[model samples]
Target chain A: MAREPGGEKIVNPNPMMSNGNNCQRLFRLLLGLLLAVLAAGLGYVLSSLPSPAPGLSKPVAEHLEASGVSNPVTAVLLNYRAYDTLLELGVLLLAPLGVWSLGVAARHREPLVDPVLDMLARLLVPMLILVAGYLLWAGAHAPGGAFQAGSVLAAAGVLLLLSGWWPGPAFSGLPLRVSLTAGPGVFLVAGVALMFAGGRMLEYPPPFAGALILLIEAAATWSIGITLAALFAGGRPVAGPHR
Target chain B: MSLLQPVFDIVLGLALLWLAWRAVASPDLFRGIVLFIAFGLVMALVWVRLDAPDIALAEAAIGGGLTGALLLATLARLESGGGAGTGRGKDRESEPNDE
Candidate 1:
């Protein structure tokens, strides 16, 4: 029997409950042992693998010109494996959708006014936005891309939210929804349009591939940014009386 | 310099494993979350060491920063909704209104 903080004697009605702690400990030990064995096996397998394993880098480099981006990662994502990227965007869009479905609106609280935080948000948000733009633009030839840029943008949004800046009602409604859907929407539209034009879905004409990739990336960055930020908000933004 | 790289890598790998273990086994929820974030940041460093800067950037931004924020916010909400010192082991059925 355990005593509660309020001096109430808590009785364990179930006899089996007495051994629960020991059972749990034994279970954990077994699980940990199993995991250790698995890890060792995996490590052994990895160590036995061929060094510098032959990959598709050669073929990717060969087709890089036609893929419309100098960066092989970007080429693969936006061209060779565009369908995967499209689906990925769809998955990203689903996050906020699932969160919003929980029907919990973010509780409106009084803004905590801290001068330093306010100044930091003001200074950092714009800089972060600029960095996101640069990242989107540089994706064609660098490590940065829509996902990274969008995450940075989300960081900025989170900073603002933390510093007590809420989106205006006007911006949070239709505009928010549109931005959230823009990535997958654009990708889907492009794929369907390309199919209509007699090419395979998401097949970019070699001449127009660069332009199309940039457009898709820009939309994806926006959508991902908004989606992640909305996800952090944790629920639907209920306005006016409902809020 | 070459020897230093290997030493650094070994240290980082051990730190990552230790942090991950501590994060999982920590008794306090807040401490566990903070350790998890530290684990994430360390994981990001490992990604960079593995020459995957893209993954590193994404991991740092999303995994470390945003996840930490989300977890802390959730903890705060849980504490507020359930009242202090009673955030855990409470009956879910009793709390009808989240606010």
Candidate 2:
């Protein structure tokens, strides 16, 4: 850095650094151009393809009655492609477990004792819980489901934690573990049960599909709620001193 | 009224693009996160316009709300850890206290 005659500070660029910067700029420009061309080519090819006469939605709707759910989306999720739903639940459970594997954080029990937050939690948590339950129940007919309900439930838990009413380790225990795995466990059991009952794996008998889906959803909601809450907690909870 | 719908769509689309660009380009991490949360919110509106209320709800709740909260908390933790110990910046002392 040096002051020029005009009293302006100037820093000389190193030759090697300038060369590296130029290389990066060239690479970025080439990458952008290649991606743009690829995108345009793909778009052209896709647009040229003829549209299907009968879309998949029609068939999905036709078979929806047999899936035991009124909502076509729910029918598709809980019945038509239950394997995917099972895997998604497994992934949700994996998140908390993965966090736990990182080892516990130093336990500093600092309860945020703000009056406003406490009051807000008191007013909102119970109402949010009700909304979550409603969303779960409405999934059979409406645009809500285990995932949405579970997210709301997790939000309530987070609210409580923020207000300092709920301890960090409140969710840590054998019972919590069981609840965390309940969704995928129940889903697996249902699959195995169907296999034993003369149906293919995950192929719920038509008469019983509705009940099975509801049961699986209930379990999944619980597990998802716990999993999301644990993820926000950011570390494994050890057994509390009280425990 | 039909013209209004198209106008709204154009405006929303432009807003979404602008918010996304700013979110990705912001130099400050905190500002970037706040912009990202706003982008999620606008994206939820896009989902609503596309007639996917379920996705809109999920995006707003999870993407905008919970994810924003988690990111903010993580930022606070990081700042508190690095700021308090290293005394890197003059603003370090006041940062954790704000939380």
Candidate 3:
């Protein structure tokens, strides 16, 4: 709150400077207090909860047979509620574009972290990728599916971003473009193909419902992974400065 | 209060709020950007607890991930040729020149 000048220090020492500092400190303090209150409320909800849902889908159960995808949540996400997933992809598309527009771009060197953290990221990456694939495949019977699987993959992308591997903004290229469009593109084409062949849009024509759902989900899974990784890169036009 | 849900919820919530508060309070604009990314992830978890998987996925993938990237990129632009923070200061300095 004190300032020194060549000769002006004795006069006022810029009372405005002290006032600005006080305002900033007060702002931070109030912000912390607000956060504390929010945290307390959140703590109450998280630590106190009801039992988990039975992992069943009421809509799927009521109208149709299992379709052999025993995990009703998977069925709901991939089949019954497939449209929601499509729109989700749309939001994914908008985020990066917004970066290029609303955000300024940068061309920075990447950040450096503790070697131990780097090692952990390295170790976690491949394992998470494998787990994601397995989860995607097993969604037919387990409490996992495209969404969960995609998240795990996204987690890996995040790890890559944090670890200075994939970098950011400069992520634009063939692969990124491909991954971004692949999910909904495949579904739209497949649905059209089925429609042209006399089936309904996204209608698998009987027993293949599960298979079609799987394919759509697989595409979605890959798209989600890429989108997340790139999105984690945010709007920076390039990599980041080493911190 | 049931079982593990509450525990996860509290962790998720506090983690998010901390990030938000820090992002607001951080003196170095760059630090605030990073903290905001963390805040996004924690909020994604909150969406999950609310049983909105769709929202959670979007939050995690787009909200948390891309927004951080954008902020970092902006900081990069602010830094550009010289060095990041210095470049930003230079840009600030050049403001009067443009006028």
Candidate 4:
């Protein structure tokens, strides 16, 4: 063991240990340089690309009216490439599923009963829910959409959890499961039903496209909110009598 | 106005890079996580600067807020579980020796 002049013990007293630290530092520096070079190369390549790059914006705009949403982003996500969105919902569902499959019970901590946090949670959660609803609805015409809205809703859920509010046993069992699955389930069912209704999977009739997209977004928002919060919970709820 | 926007963008880009490096290199795990969250937020601003508000919102909410919370919670759990060679315990163990 080596001691500093001020009588401080050096954890890595061995000369070889110091060499190893130098090697680690050198490796990190080299890696950073490599990444920087790669990034610069990528930027150079991007800069050389033709301005006003050819894209699908024209075609998307041409068919936007039929896609049922005034917002082009919404149209792209829900109508133009709905299958991708459906799979994304599945991927979101997989997260909580994987976490829950670990079968660990959520750690129950003693709830800190702070008046300010309690009041904030009470005030903010409802407002978040409202904002989520507005986002979902306005997504048809603006920048708002299911993902943004669901994330807001999820934020609210996270806040509630942070404030030490846990779902009741009754709500956590079947209802919770349903909410978690609702987005993907609705999407899958809609696709299958459309397939059976004399159309290809997810090929919405222009007349009903708006309604269908809205329905899916609504379900997706709820499911995403609940699913994300369940992820924050870090485990499955213990099986109550209802289960 | 145009010059100001570009200058702001440049500063933001530099800040993002600095924050990212600090977050990765910071010795303290908690400080690293907080820095990472800050990095996420700055990245969100970058997204907005690129005119991608949707991505910006998602980044702010999921990337910064939820993920930060999750990381903090995981760190707390790791500290409480007395995981060897991880988190605050290592710092605490080395603190007295340093003095």
Best by TM-score: 1
Give the per-residue lDDT of model 4 (tens digit) for A1-243. 222222223356567987877776797789979999999999999999999999999999999999999999999999989999999999999998887775544553667899999999999999999999999999999888999899899999989988988887888789999999999999999999999999999999999999999999999999999988888877678776412
Model 1 DockQ, alpha carbons vs. true complex: 0.30
* Per-residue alpha-carbon lDDT of candidate 2 for residues B10-97, written as tens digits (9 for 90 to 100): 9999999888877766655688789889999999999999998888878887988788877876676666553111233334454543
For TM-score, candidate 3 versus 4, the one ahead is 4
**What's the distance in Å from true for residue A171, model 3?**
8.4
DockQ of each: 0.30, 0.25, 0.16, 0.28
lDDT of 2 by residue, A1-243 (tens): 122222222233566877776776697789989999999999999998887745679899898889988988788889999999999998888888776776553322467878888889999999999998998889999988888888898899778767775444565688789989999999999999999999999998889999999999999988888778777766666687522
Model 1 lDDT per residue over A151-188, tens place: 99999988888898778778878999999999999999
TM-score of chain A of each: 0.89, 0.86, 0.67, 0.90
**Alpha-carbon DockQ of candidate 4:** 0.28
In Å, residue A58's CA in model 4 sits off its true spot by: 1.1
User: What DockQ would candidate 2 receive versus the native complex?
Assistant: 0.25
**On a 0 to 1 TM-score scale, where does candidate 2 land against the true structure?**
0.85
Fnat, one value per model: 0.28, 0.19, 0.07, 0.26
> Which is the winner by TM-score between candidate 2 and candidate 4?
4
Quote the positional error of residue B52 for candidate 4 in Å.
1.2
Q: Pick the winner on DockQ between candidates 2 and 3.
A: 2
| Candidate 4 docking band | acceptable
- Of the candidates numbered 2 and 4, which has the greater lDDT value? 4
After TM-score superposition, the amount by which residue A131's alpha carbon in candidate 1 deviates from its true location, in angstroms, is 0.6
Predictions in order: lDDT: 0.84, 0.79, 0.68, 0.85
CA-RMSD of model 1: 5.4
Using all chains and alpha carbons, the TM-scores for the candidates as numbered come to 0.88, 0.85, 0.58, 0.88
